[model samples]
Target: MDAERGEGSPHGGDGRLRRRAFLVGGGLAALGLGGTALAIGPDGFRNAYARVVCGGVPDPPVARPGARRLSEVEGRTVIVSLPPRPRDRTTVVIMFPEGTENARASLDLCSADRYLAASGGRFAVAAIDDWPSADVVGTVLPHLETQGFDTGRIGLLGWAAGGAEALRLAAQLGSGRVAAVAAASPAVTAARAPLRDLVDIPVWLGCGERDDRAPQTETMLKGLRALGATTEGGISSGCQDTAYRVRVLPEQFAFFSRHL
Candidate 1:
């Protein structure tokens, strides 16, 4: 057999050489042969692949306890409730994500009551109504006060679109009333309003590596960094089944424990 045409030869007549040559030529073409490389480079391709294969994280356990209407403001109904363990010292304020009936469904699915109870009575959970056009923090402040909550020790938590809303509320309240904020797959787009001074507040951001909402989380992180905020982020371990994972909740609880 001719040396160049042997099975192990780089230029062998076998199919492998042709395939390798095609791949190399395609890569060079994509790189413009001299100019800047393609915007979607090899790394981008890999990331896209990972997202497609891994899927989104699992949703946190739902807190299903009979809902009690707390107040009605601007045609919106706000609610408050005690978690399984009503004697918990920690107070959690949850801002439900935006949209219609689905938003309410998300609040129910989150099961804030169950989460707090599972945390060993470490938190007393409360939730606001669906997305509204007013200052949610201001709307709920009075109710929280009546409930004997020390606003200074309160932690803000939100899910999906509500995550951004929660952060915005926290920023508005400042570090005095809100000690920390937690978000899961926040809908952080360019058009999303910017958060106020958050440099002194602690923030926890959670997203599934393969979540469709990853871009939003990335944008939120960038905004937080610009404000010189102290931010911690993590990839959820369970992204193959549920749309979000549980790591964010525990991590958020820990953050509140330390800060609040």
Candidate 2:
């Protein structure tokens, strides 16, 4: 979470109003994790942190005709949907998160939507809610087809735990429905047998500079290279935010655009 800054004035015409307001606001911020700062403006107090977290946030409802909740896997319900323009050539993104199913942090599929829409409607993006499950992907395929997507051209985008899942699913599919796989901040380790072999499709892996799991990502990349896979690794400057390294998504978009 990012730190916050705030400013305010004291009431009752106190000479120390500004100083007092600063102390109070600072105290309030100290008690909270992921607090944003505010400043006293002509219109009164303004919160910068709230702006960052809530800025341009979209509604949670998936309102398209084919946009509906699918059956739950292991008690967690998954969502499947098609882009607004369904007839275009489609690409599927199987998203898996590193947190609880209900958290808003896992709702970053908006970026994926934007990417597909910008690509001449050449792709459709679908975010799966369950952890690395091939069954979930299989279940969502028909739902995507109902939305008019070409499931044969779909791709996978996995982050953190989902990255590991993406690799597993890629190997499981073996170039069937999946065209490529992109793993951002993948929690790849030597223990996974499926990830040991290099995937035949294009694979892109990335991590953050301040991420504690950089070593694990590097190990996974090395393993993929050893398997004769077409692989690329990227590094971002910021720390992990909501299980995603912000820069990795755009890069992944470019990779998918080129390969998928």
Candidate 3:
């Protein structure tokens, strides 16, 4: 879900644009979700396609303090983290990372611990080796609900391709069940999710000016807004596509906090 700076984004830079395509196996380990195995080209398609095309902002590392657990639920593997004591009205954050390599790294990048702390232990975080999408939300959603999470307070976060995947899940599940969705430099090449279905969902897109993926994200934001989804995004000057996931994480945390 993060990356380095590049030049020539139409957002105002003059460098050539670059796009990375990923091919992942179901076993690839993702940020804090436990590692899943991957099969990719030696050229790094697994890493590149999983990240967004952009350019750089720096921030403190994203880490949470608590015990981490890996287990199986309903035939799927999941990683869960909780504050020593959780509060009532907990928000459930389900995330997908930018690449197979950063699967476990996603927990900090998405500010899972910060949410738990900010909400006074009112957030429970969970992630899986494979993102819960149209193919799996049916199973993942019900399983999470059975585990004591408020299905109505779900939030979805992803980096690069994951962001678009989050949007796809939001559309499939409907706003009645999802509260917020966030994406950073997502590698979404098409708008496959039905905008009409996101009328009441709140979505936040974070990307930098120097990042080449800004236009696509901004376009998606515009589409979501036009379709009446409550949407907002931060377009920071000099922010790189690779770096925005961490750099704008604080902003993302606040957005999810308000919506969740």
Candidate 4:
């Protein structure tokens, strides 16, 4: 749903262009039911607002075949989906679930399993359900290495709150360990200290035009670009929920493929 920013984009001559493109394309649909109509009752209002502004409540994602749950990895739940025929030094994309969603929800929301299966096994996908720490990667990487994945090349994908976590991880792990990062509707309001660690890493960020977090994401994107960090993506159609995040997944994966 997000506009691809390259040499030329509709909103502006440069990538600094903001939400006009997405709003022009999807404004009406994004304003579904209108704000007044959604303010009727608490539950009704919340659901309506979510649908119109936070992306519709998506159905639970069905698990694709070849997906495996590995609870033994550092005693934490990790869902891994490998390519049907993986290379001995296979690259891996590690996904961080948003908020309280589990690893499975992360995989389903982003459709990482399907992406891997349909994309000809270019890389493996793993999702973990931990927060605020980079230590998980230390254990997860070694485990993946034993399982035949190349731990050296790694990509990180994070949603909403997880986006900040991904940035933090990439910073803590450094570019030597983390190849790239893709953050969707990230909760980051400004370029924080962690960003200082990512100047060498390619970071792709996207958010919905209607999402409350869009402005923050835009600010972050601009700040990153100002800092000369390798960045892409801006505001997109839809909101801050699963639908919008899912819409941005393809570009994220593509970015990872090019970097990781």
Candidate 5:
């Protein structure tokens, strides 16, 4: 955008911000070789871009309850929650909300308490901050292992942009390497183009049928299924926006539990 019309990039001086500015309103769509196009509008992307310049921002304080604490790993602040009693098989659930502030809240929003209790000692829910790359698994897993987490049966659950990361991580890690992958209102722009690499990993995708994000999620699921990825997807009936409703929490949680 021109200098006069400056709603594009939050930080107007940088070349990087200039490029990101174009995506500020329209968001990003995934398009590439033999891949289906997926659309993710500016809402989640804007939320993510807002965190880019947060150089000195502090991590969100631990407030949500249930054996919660903050850990600085790989220069990223991760919020981890554990159950009262753990199990032999640890189901590490890595969540990627738009920003650190939404990390812990996403868990509670999903009613992690019931599932975590039902999961017994088998599940650990961790939410990450920043624009984490696929190597995030390497960054988070070791810490979990050192903390007495079994490091087996890893699952990825995400909302909006974070859902994109969840799916991307599953692709990077591949089938058996990742036990289950669930996403709520996954934004197509969150994942890079060429989703066929995720053909082996099963994805449980949920979207609000009435939201603008539904078309995007449906397109993404169709493309992945065409590639032979074992996938299950549904539109939640009682939501206004598809980004993590009060309903799909247990539905997705049950999927993860079955796989774990």
Candidate 6:
């Protein structure tokens, strides 16, 4: 497990703009305001703020040759991105988007499809429009198998509250069913009831050192280690924003590739 750090602090003209937007967007999120309003404010903040902070107000992913969307999985829509040359039976990475994002937007934010394509079809990426629970995994796994994914080897990725859901799902399902998990700024609670189930699971946890969730991420890392779980993680320099995602995602993808 390598320690990765994001370089530099927000400064200068562009950096100041980014820093300002980050503060505004984070404040809005804290107030439970809709991202739609933040991204499309009546003022020109959309062009100036979201462009730097909220990942430019993610658009619905464009329909293309290799892109696939499925609506038959228990009435939940799933967005799938296969590698350029997918294998017959490849591992799948399921993404649990943060509250403000949809499946396609989540995938876009993480650049997951491009990473899979760069992997040369080593694995597939799937994002569910709805947050998943342990019960949902039973449905998702079988459905993915039907779609040519090797359901036995599955990776879970998520951010913010979604990351907490991924952890809860991994705990409920256990390591036998879930191959690995990668979480960024997960809003994990202090409850230790689920720690035992994660002992056998491979986890990679990351968060921005200045982010509100940093303390919890540290606690989780310590808790996992105390349980002897194969855990690897680090705190970087950004928050729950786009820069943090850029810094952590490549390593997260590599972590999944190794375990899944």
Best by TM-score: 4
Error of 4 at 168 (Å): 0.9
What tens digits encode model 1's per-residue C-alpha lDDT throughout 41-152?
5444444334345543445555454334365555666555555544433365555554433333544554544555455444555655545454556666655666665555
Candidate 4, poorest ten consecutive residues by summed lDDT: 16-25
Residue-by-residue lDDT tens digits, candidate 3, 89-169: 456777777665333566755456554554444456777765533234667667766766666668887777777777777
Put down candidate 4 lDDT per residue, 76-134, tens digits, no spaces: 67677776666667788888768867677767665667656654546778877664443
User: In terms of TM-score, how similar is model 6 to the real structure?
Assistant: 0.71
Cα lDDT of model 6 by residue, 152-254, tens digit: 8578888888788878888887888899988889887646427788889899998987688888788888888988999887777666776676567768878
Backbone clashes, each candidate: 7, 6, 30, 0, 2, 0
Error of 4 at 227 (Å): 2.5
Regions of candidate 3 where Cα sits further than 4 Å from its true position? 1-67, 83-85, 101-103, 108-111, 114-121, 132-135, 190-193, 238-242
What is residue 257's positional error in candidate 3, in angstroms?
1.5
Candidate 6 Cα errors over 4 Å, as ranges = 1-71, 119-121, 132-135
**What C-alpha lDDT does candidate 2 achieve relative to the native structure?**
0.58
Kindly list the per-residue Cα lDDT of model 2 for residues 58-79, writing each as its tens digit: 3333333233334444455555
What is candidate 3's CA lDDT for residue 239?
Answer: 46
Residue 99 error, candidate 5, Å: 3.5
lDDT of each: 0.59, 0.58, 0.62, 0.72, 0.62, 0.72
Off by over 4 Å in 2: 1-89, 102-105, 108-110, 118-121, 129-134, 191-193
- Residue 105 local lDDT, model 6: 78
Query: Which tens-of-lDDT digit does each residue in 1-260 have in candidate 5?
Result: 44755555554555455456454533323212111111333344554433332211233223343577677777766677776655654557777765444555656555565556554434677776563553566667887777667666588887777777778778778776788888887766424534786777778887876656787777878887778877876765533332234456656766776776
As a whole number from 0 to 100, the lDDT of residue 163 in candidate 6 is 83
